[model samples]
Target chain A: MNLRIIKSGVLDTVQDQGRYGWQHIGINASGAMDRFSAELANALVGNDSAQPVLEMHFPAASLFFEQPSLIAICGANFSAVLNGEPVPCYQPILVNKYSILQFERLNQGARAYLAIEGGMNIGKWLNSYSTHLKAGAGGHAGRPLSTDDEIRLNSSVDWQSYLERNEFRVLPWRASDFWEKEPVDEIYILPGREFSGLTELSQLSLTGKTFTLTPQSDRMGYRLLGDPLEMQNREEMISTAVTFGTIQLLPNGQLTILMADHQTTGGYPRIAHVISAHHSRLAQLSPAEKLRFRITDYSMAEVLYRRQQQHLHQIRYACQLKLEWFIHAGH
Target chain B: MSLTIPYHIFPLGDSAMTVDFGSRISPELNSAVMKLYHELQLTPLPGMVEAVPAYSSLSVHYDLLYCSRHRPAEQTVFEWMGELLDKRLRKLDYEEIIPSREVVVPVCYDISLAPDLEMLARERNLSVEEVIHLHQAAPYRVYLLGFLPGFTYLGETDERIAMPRKMQPSPVVAGSVGIAGRQTGIYSLSSPGGWNIIGRTPLKLFDKDREPLTLLKPGDIIKFVSISKDEFEDH
Candidate 1:
């Protein structure tokens, strides 16, 4: 099966989990900004959680299916249509050859994922298919998909069963089952490397004040506009390794939330790290969206993380059980 | 007696924990970080996924679920990790050395690429020739790699060539050489830079297709060789 791009939209690129084992050489682990959504889309189509999928930005992507295939759209609620008929999201559906797919602007959320059954066929770099835009590596010649670009499945995997099972609408199933569907705006965080550098009052304000996400946001980091946080130290720091969700406190007292495509290292004093459980919200937050950071202890953060994992495992198990039932319950 | 190294282990973000050996930069701390990194990766914990070694610390990435499953209720994961690191360091054999490659970077000290060459020389109270000589005098060590892909942040800049960064950042084209404080680096990609522009090299510090893509590795020695624009273009 294959897909031909009609309109490439604002930004669209193939991504997987991430590239690991290379940070010693200064390579940042560039992967999907909204990782949970990416994983769900992959799981919906019976693909491994790490398989590559298309990360579409702000909708506007249009494609033509060259053959019948099973596909799933997950993540933000983007207005998607097939052959001018409004299509529901967060479920797998089959498309016949030459079918046109269009994605319009979303009312909320900034990014979404579209997963094909066999996953997008792309050259893997350092064991990953995700594109690191700055380094110009992996996925579609190390660049975002442009107009007229064609993407093919890794293998000629037949989706006859999938098509037959899922034809009209998404099976009476839930996409949030495999991932999270809770209100994600309330971000949870743990004190970080420079958490002590802030004044007690500033530390108190960190949990109290609500900041709005600014327009200056991307895969690199989020520039938040809010109360200027005060710090205890003014010393310059030697550069060190940093990662996504690292809340760095700048000299001017502003907060910058690092994201997926964040630099491999930084020198700023970090105030906190948003908890892993709250990262999906970081990915979907649109500009001007108000966000609040809830300070929690390491133990509590770990608990939340374990809960997410248990929830995910249960969802995967439930999905399998349902699939088995579908196969046995008289066609 | 060797002074007890004061350190702290804290989170970098939700998924990462940073163990800072010291608040200040020193060769002792760097070696300690490298040593701890080797030991940690050798005997990793249940959820420990990746380690990012830095100048004065090692940041560890882990899976929260795995960590919780293996964590003992009596001992906090943070305390266990700290104790584990301490034990590793205490038992560490200082005689071991990691293999590192030696890289010689060629630089063309031409007028075109070094747009701020004259200005930098004037500010440092040195002749252009004197600046060039001082820059090429000592071998620089790759202290850390960051800011951009394959950007080698070398340590201990030449005191003579050391100058403050450009008051106003210049839009430097890729491969431009620059110095700030006791450090020097090449802008591997076109970026808004504040380093004092010295010259540019034709070397591609980062090439994705190449196995071991980045040209320079941490702990490697880098020497700048002066060349002409013709020589730079030819390569």
Candidate 2:
């Protein structure tokens, strides 16, 4: 299957779980900002969890499907439309040859994920299909898709037969369980190594007040505007490795939460880390969104992470079973 | 001589932990970090994915699922990892030899290539020739690779020419050799930088097609060799 980019909206790029095992050498793990949605989209189309999905920002891409293929859309509802008809997210859709899919406007969330059956056949650098924009490597010539760009999909033999047998434009069943409700905007974080470095007043301010995401926010980090969180002492710290959810305090008393495209290492003092379970929800937050932080311990964080992973595993298994049954019934 | 360094392990998040050797930058501390990094790589514990060595610390990232499965049921992932790291720390032989590479970086110090050469020399009350001589005279060590891919942070420059970063960062071309404070490095990728650009190199610090991607790894010894602009262009 082939997809022709009709209108490449702002910051549309192919991303997977992220490039790992390379951070030691200063490589950012550039991946889907909202992993939960990306994985769900892939699962809806019976694709592997690590398969590359189009991570589109608000006012997402418009594409032309060159062949009949099974696809899924998830994450932010960008008012997706197929051939001028509104299409719902969190389910598999069958697009006929020459059908145009377009996203009109953002209904909710900051990003969206679009997945096709058998995944995108894009170039993978450092064992990942993620595009590291700064280095200009990986995923479709290491850059965002532009108008007229053609993205080829890994064609599956069974898909051709399924398309011929099916008359409906979408699967009867939707992966409704995988769809998360609207976010509450409350982010839970665990105290970091330098949590104690913050002044007592600053520590209280972290949880007692609200913070707004500043305009300077990007994939690298979200520079928050709120109370100036001051540290107890003016101490110098050596640069060290930082991860996706690391919250760092700048010298000017500003707080920045490192996101999906965060640098491998940073010198800013790490104040806290947003738990892994809430990462997808955090990714969906846009600039100027009001958010509050809640303190949680390590054990609680681990429990939440494990529970989410278990939920995803169950969802994947169920989706695979459903797809298998559907294919066998068609035969 | 055998040397033993003390270190502390702290949790960065649910999925990562950090082993800090010290707060200050020094050859000994960096070597210690590299040694620990190598040791961990050679005998990786359960769930350990990667170990990132910085100037004086090593950040170890792990897979929580794998760790939970392998760890004792009674202990949490953090507790299990802390204990496992402590055991490894006790067993590590500081006397064990660590491996490193010596790399020669060719630089073109022509006035045209170095946009900030005249300004830097004037600010330091020295001739441009003197500045170039001091930069290439000493062998520098790769403290870390950060800020950008393949951008190696080399340290311990001769204090005579040591200066601060530019008051404001401007657009720097790739392979621009820059110096700020006690460190000098070549920009692997073109981006805005505040460092004083004293020369340029033809070598690509980072290439995706290359085997290792980066030209210099941490702990490698780097020696700058001055070459004429013609030599640089020819290569």
Best by lDDT: 2
Q: lDDT (0-100) at residue A189 of candidate 1?
A: 88
The digit string of per-residue lDDT tens for model 1 on A106-130 reads 8567888888877777779889999
- Lowest lDDT sum, 10 consecutive residues, model 1 chain B, at B76-85
Quote the lDDT for A8 in model 1. 82
Residue-level error in angstroms, candidate 1, position A261:
0.3
Per-residue error for B212 in candidate 1, Å, reads 2.1
Candidate 1 runs further than 4 Å off: A155-157, A160-169, A177-182, A324-331, B1-6, B41-45, B95-101, B167-169
Q: A307, model 1: CA deviation in Å?
A: 1.7
The DockQ of predicted model 1 stands at 0.67
| Top candidate, metric DockQ | 2
**What ranges in model 2 sit over 4 Å off?**
A157-168, A177-183
Q: Native contacts retained per candidate?
A: 0.70, 0.61
